[model samples]
Target: MPWWSWILIWVALVALSLLLYVFLGIRLFRQFMATLKDLGAAGKKMGHISPLEQAQTRPEAGRPLPGSAVFASPTVMRHDYEASKSSRREQRRLKRVQRKTDRGQPQALGDLDFT
Candidate 1:
C-alpha cells in the first residue's frame, strides 16, 4: 500500500534472485569440476585396467577362440567385398559431383598458398 513498503519488497525480491543465481552457479561449477576429476581418474584407471586385461589373457586369445574363426571367416571374407565394390563406385560418383561443385565455388585462402 505504502510506497516505501513496495520499494522494500522489490529490493528483497532482487536480492533473493541474485542469491539463488550465485548459489546455483557455484554448485554447478563444483559439479563440473568434480566430473572432470572423476573422468581423469577413470581414464587413468582404464589405462591400467586395459594393460592388466591384456596381460591376464593368453597370447593365443588374440588369434582365435578355437573353431569360432571358421564361422567368422566367411562373413568377413564375403560380406564386405560386394559392398566395397559398390562403395568404390559410389565414391567415384561422389568425386565427380564434388569436382563439378568445386568448379562453381570460390577457392579458400589455403588453396592459394602451399607450404
Candidate 2:
C-alpha cells in the first residue's frame, strides 16, 4: 500500500476511537444519573417510615426510639415495652455470642465457660 493509504487508515482508526469514547462517556453519564435517582428514592422511602409509624405497627421489629410508647412512664402498652426490651436483650445476647465465637470459644480451664 502507498504511504498515503496507511495515513488514511490511521486517521479512520483515530476517528473511530474518538466516536467510541464519546458514546461510552454519554452512556455512563446516563447510567450514573439513573443510579443516583434510585438511591434518592430509597432514601425517601426510609424517611417515610418514622419511628412513630414503625412503633405503631411493629415496635419490636426495630431499634427502640427515644420517648416511644415502650419507654413511657408506667408503660401504657406493656406488650410494646416488653417487645422492645426483648429485642434489645436479644441484641446484647447476640453480641456476646459473637464475641465468644470471635474469641474462639474460651479454652476449658477446669470448669470454666467452654463457649
Candidate 3:
C-alpha cells in the first residue's frame, strides 16, 4: 500500500477506537445511574419505617430486641460501671508509675563503648 493510504487507515482505526470507548463509557454511566436510583428508592423505603417497628418485625435467635435492657437489673448495670471505673483508675496509676521509672533510667546508647 501507498504511504498516504496507510496513514488514512491508521486515522480511521484511531477514530473507530475512540468512538467505541465513548460508547462503552456512556453505557456504563447509564447503568451506574440506574443502580444509584434503585439504592435511593430502597433507602427512602427504609427511612419510612421506624427502627422500633422494624426490630419488632424481625425475629433474632439469640439477641434481644431494640430497647430492652441487656443486663438483668439496674443494680447489675451500676456494679458493672463501678468495676470498669476502678479498672481504668488502676490502669492510669500503673501508667503513671511506669512513666516515672522510664524517666529515671538512662536511655543513651553512647554510654556503651564499641572497640
* TM-score, one value per model: 0.44, 0.43, 0.46
**Candidate 2, residues 8-97: lDDT per residue as tens digits?**
999999999999999999999999999999999999989877877765674455555556654576655776778879888878766776
- Give per-model CA RMSD: 18.3, 11.4, 15.6
Q: Which regions in candidate 3 have their CA more than 4 angstroms from the true location?
A: 50-115
The digit string of per-residue lDDT tens for model 1 on 7-33 reads: 999999999999999999999999999
Clashes of each: 0, 0, 0
Q: Candidate 1 regions off by >4 Å?
A: 49-115
lDDT of 2: 0.77
Give the worst 10-residue stretch by lDDT in candidate 2.
Answer: 106-115
Report the lDDT of model 2 for residue 44.
95
Which residue pairs clash in candidate 1? none
What TM-score quantifies how close candidate 3 is to the native fold? 0.46
Error of 1 at 54 (Å): 6.8
Please give the lDDT score for candidate 1: 0.75
